[model samples]
Target: MSEHHEHRHPHGHEEHTQDVRAHRGHGPGRRFARWRHRLRHAVTPHTHDSSDKVDGALESSARGMRALWVSLAVLGVTAAAQAGIVVLSGSVALLGDTVHNAADALTAVPLGVAFVLGRRAASRRFTYGYGRAEDLAGIVIVLTIAASAVFAGWTAVNRLLDPRDMDHVGVVAAAAVVGFLGNEWVARYRIRVGRRIGSAALVADGLHARTDGFTSLAVLLSAAGAAIGWRYADPIVGLLITAAILLVLRDAAGEVFRRVMDAVDPALLGRAEDALRRVRGVREVGELRMRWIGHRLRAEVALVVDADLTVRQAHDIAVDAEHALLHAVPKLTAALVHADPAPAADGPDPHLALAHHMTA
Candidate 1:
């Protein structure tokens, strides 16, 4: 089978650089292209350009980064407020919750770094790009959650054995409300951006913050228990928060582990196939592969076209296939479309595809 290939990525669209000269032009169009070309490369940290596929990837990553920084600011302020309450109340439950909030605020650091790294251009050694850094950040987030769980659990156990009087109960309750509001706001923003950007790691981070907000509410319960003369209530709530943290750990760990293993949503593959079939000259969809490289998605596909098509014609088909996938698949930053020659009309169909196959 004769194969012609086309590719695309981060800031621009490329039909295929099958012919090097096809990419170079003269006059005003060339000047405009040059500016956009420079902008795409300059904006993206990674060199995984489909020649210059500056579309949604650049905008999406930028949005993810903005969300991280904003969330960091909001959470930091919330943690500071809670810290003041912890100092005044001497409530260990509030202290544990405060610590978790601080850690949640700090998690934005790793996530932000991941976003920055993910923007770097792709190189020969890392053809898929540095998008995997976000997944690594997700690992850090999961570990932080686990650490918070252990710390909270230990404090709860210690207090269970030796209960202490909690002061400034009213102040602690008010602080808990502040923590909840702040964290919930950050959580919503993070999750919204993460989902829009197709970043599993960011989504996990948001969930972590949401969990912290719930723990903050638990601090409120601890204060109520103290008011009611239930000496064990504060520590019990702490222990419960620990259990909740563990549950969140399970979820975040599963998400990160799956991404580390390069697992993607099944629906994505279906969309890729549908997109390939929609192309005018794609006879049969052979093999389609997709994976998340950080928050951006990259795809590779094998497409069958009529055997008699010229190399140039096959290249055009591949170009169309790539363009279709880019438009149809969500969050897809790059794609490699390989056009394979189908069996001649008289020969037996080896791939045995359905009757919907296209003809030359």
Candidate 2:
């Protein structure tokens, strides 16, 4: 039996070119038709094709970069405000919160660099492009979080050893509120964009921002206790903030590690299998696998087809199956479909010799 392979990189530019030609006709209704087409394309989900995939990847990277810059600006302003309060009130809790905000803002630097690198085209040396840079950025972010936690913990311990009065309690409380508002806003924006773009690193950064917001609230509690004449409350709240940072660090680290290990959701595998099975002329769906390359997904599938079918027929079936998978699986940019001829019911296994040789 012969094996047939269908490798397709779908391109939709021809359709786009035709559309442009159609719009070139000078009729009043032509403008309306063109506008309608544009509206439909904008509102509809994008078809899985090479052109669209490239465009989507670039657009997603641009959006991620924007999110990082906007977050950095907001957090920078918030941290500066909190830093002033820290100096005036000498509140350990406020100081720790400020440190966290500053570290969170700086993390965007590495992520932005990764996004830029991810945009580079695939070369002979790096066949998959620079998408893995995002994973490296994630590691850096994890380390930054760990460092902030240690610094916060040490500062809190030192404060506990030598209790001190905090001045400008009202200003410190106001700064804490500002920090919370800024971090929450940045967190929401980052997480929303990250999920849409399928970026794990961006999502982890968003989680970090959210934890910083909660820690900022802890700073407010410290300010309140100080106002009420509890000298130990500030240091205790600082320690609590440190604990919260550690918790977020664990979560962020786990998420990044999963991405690095190419761990995809099991549901995606099921969906891919179901899509392949639904394709006409597919006798059976064999080994199906998917892995993430940055924010996009790639799949490899083995398909069983009729043994008597011509090579061209089997190839067509494989093409159809690949199209179905691209349509059904979200974020899947490419797929390799291999069609195998099914063995006859009364005949020896076609692959037995190959399997035996491999074992030997």
lDDT of each: 0.78, 0.81
Q: Which candidate should be chosen as best, given TM-score against the real structure?
A: 2
**Span of 10 residues, lowest total lDDT, candidate 1:** 14-23
**What ranges in model 2 sit over 4 Å off?**
1-49, 84-96, 346-348, 353-360
Please give the range of 10 consecutive residues that has the lowest summed lDDT in model 2.
Answer: 11-20
Give the lDDT of residue 247 in candidate 1. Answer: 90
In candidate 2, what are the lDDT values of residues 1-360, reduced to their tens digit?
Answer: 555454334332212323333343448766876787577567666454666567877888999999999999999999999898888878666776798789768889889999999999899999988989988988888887787788768877898899888788899899999999999999999989998888889988898788778778877887898899998987798799889989989998998999999999999999778767776677899888888887778888989988998887777777767766766787777788888889889988877878856854
Screening candidate 2 with a backbone cut-off below 3 angstroms (N, C-alpha, C), the clashing residue pairs are: none
lDDT of 1 by residue, 1-360 (tens): 556565665423432222222224459765776577566547545355454455455677789889988898898899888888888878666777787788668888888888888777779998767788999999998888887778778988998999877788899999999999998998899888888888888988988898888788778888899888888987898889889888988988898888888899998898678767766667899988888888777788988888887887788777667766765776776688877778776987655664467565
TM-score for each of the candidates = 0.81, 0.84
Give the candidate number with the greatest lDDT: 2
